[model samples]
Each structure stands twice: as structure tokens, then as C-alpha cells.
Target: MKLNVLYFAWVRERIGVASETVETDAGSINELLDELSAREERYAIAFSDRSVLRCAIDQTLVPFETSLANATEVAFFPPMTGG
Candidate 1:
């Protein structure tokens, strides 16, 4: 499937792009991340700690295990903090 992967904040800085269209055969978010991490050192660095990251599928927050079937957009960002 084709997915639009979006990166935010430090995630974008590390990856060096705000978003990209990716072709993947991943069944879940974790699988997609693994594929990306294996692509280059930058991706590995950006996704190094899954615990500090947040994800949304087509704008709806979801767990890493969430199925990616029929999903077009996937966003990765840091957890928001209130000041």
C-alpha cells in the first residue's frame, strides 16, 4: 500500500523531511517503522525510541500495533506538553 508518512518537530529534523510518500507492505505501524529504520541511519536515529513518539493514522491517534490497512496518512510526533 502507499502511505503518506509525516514527521514533526525533532522527528522531522532528524529525518530531514516533513513528509514523504512511501510504498509499504507493512501490516502495522511497528512494521512500517522497522522498514524505515532499516533504510538509513537517520531514520534509525529518528525512530530509535518509540516510547517518546506519538502516532496518528489519518489523524486519529493509534497504538503502534494498529493495523495500517486502507490507511493513507500516518504521522509521527512527540507527545505534546502543556506549559
Candidate 2:
């Protein structure tokens, strides 16, 4: 499956990219994250702490266990806060 992956805030800085197209056989968001983290140290650092991260699948918020079937986009970012 081909997925458009987006990184935000510090995640982008850590990964050194804002977005990229990823091709993977990962069945779930966790699996996809694992695949990315295994690719290099930068990815590993970016995803090192999953607790503070939020994810959206096709612009809809989803859990880490969410299935990636037919999903075209996945975005990862830190929790949003407003003052």
C-alpha cells in the first residue's frame, strides 16, 4: 500500500522532512510506525515517544491500532494545546 505520511512540529525536525510517500505492507498504524522507525536513527528519534503523538488517517483522528486499508494519508504530530 502507498501512503502519504506527514510529520509536524518537532517530529518534522527530527525526521528532517515534512512529508513523503511511503510504500509498505503494514496493516496498522503501529506497524507502519515501526517500519518507519526501523529505517533510520532519525525516524527512530522522531517516533521514540508515541505517547505524546497524535495521528490522523485520511484527516480523521485514529488510534494507533487503526487499520491502514484504503488509507491514503497519515499524519503524526504532538498533542495540540490552546491558551
Candidate 3:
């Protein structure tokens, strides 16, 4: 399936991209991360610590196990801290 992957904050810096169109065979978010992590050093650095990352599938925050079958967008970002 095709997914719009979005990166935020430091994650975007490491990946060198804010968003991308990805064709994935991943069934879940975790699987998608694994695929991205294998793409390059940047992905490795960006996704190294999964605990520090937050995700949303099609605008709804979800766990990594969330299914990606019908998702149009997936966003990844660092945990937010209010000022």
C-alpha cells in the first residue's frame, strides 16, 4: 500500500525529509519502521530509539502495532513537552 510518512522535529532532521510517499508491504507500524530503518544510516539514527518516538495513523495517535492496511498518512515525531 502507499502511505504518506511524515517526520517531525529531530526525526525530520535525521531523515533529511519532512514527508515522503512510501510503498510498503508492512502490516503494522512496527513493520514499517523496520523497513525504514533498513533504508539507510539516516533512518537508523532517526528511529534508533522507538520509545522516544510518537506515531499517528491518519491523524489518530496509535501504538506501533496499529494496522497500516488502509492508512493514508502516518506521522512520526518525538514526544511533546509543553512549555
Candidate 4:
């Protein structure tokens, strides 16, 4: 399926793009991350530490195990902080 993958803040810098359209055979967010991690060195680095990452499917925050079926967008961003 085709998915609109979005990157924010440092995630975008690490990935080298703000967003991209990708064709993936992944069933869930974690699976997609696994596949992306295998695509290249940068991708591996960006996803190297999952603890620093957060996700949203079609704009709704979700867990990594969330299903990706019928989803049109997936966003990855760093953990937020506030003072």
C-alpha cells in the first residue's frame, strides 16, 4: 500500500526529508519501521533508538503496534519536552 510518511524536527533531519510517499508491505507501524531501517544507513540511524520516537497514523497518535491498513499517513517525530 502507499503511505504518506512524515518526519518532524530531528527526525526529518535524520531522514533527510520532511515527508515521502512510500510503498510498503508492512502490516503495522513497527513493521514499517523495520522495513525502513533496512532501506539505508540513514534510515537505520533514524530508527536506531525507538524510545526517542513517537508516531501518529493519519494524524492520530498511536502505538508502534498500531495497524497500518487503510491508513493514508504516518508521522514520526521526536519525544516532546516542555519547561
Model 2, residue 8: distance off in Å is 0.5
Q: Per-residue lDDT for 5-39 in model 2, tens only?
A: 99999999999999999999999999999999999
For model 2, state the Cα shift of residue 48 in Å.
1.0
lDDT of 4: 0.97
lDDT of 4 at 43: 97
Where model 4 places Cα greater than 4 Å from the true spot, the runs are none
Model 2 regions more than 4 Å off: none
Question: Which pairs of residues clash in candidate 4, taking residues 3 or more apart in a chain or in different chains?
Answer: none
The digit string of per-residue lDDT tens for model 4 on 1-83 reads: 99999999999999899999999999999999999999999999999999999999999999999999999999999988998
State in Å the error of residue 67, model 1: 0.3
Q: In terms of lDDT, which candidate is strongest?
A: 1
Q: What is the lDDT of residue 45 in candidate 1?
A: 97
For candidate 1, what is the lDDT? Answer: 0.99
lDDT of 1 by residue, 1-83 (tens): 99999999999999999999999999999999999999999999999999999999999999999999989999999998999
Full candidate order by TM-score, most accurate first: 1, 2, 3, 4
* TM-score for each of the candidates: 0.98, 0.98, 0.97, 0.96
How many angstroms is residue 28 displaced in model 4 relative to the true structure, after the best TM-score fit? 0.3
lDDT of each prediction vs. the true structure? 0.99, 0.96, 0.96, 0.97
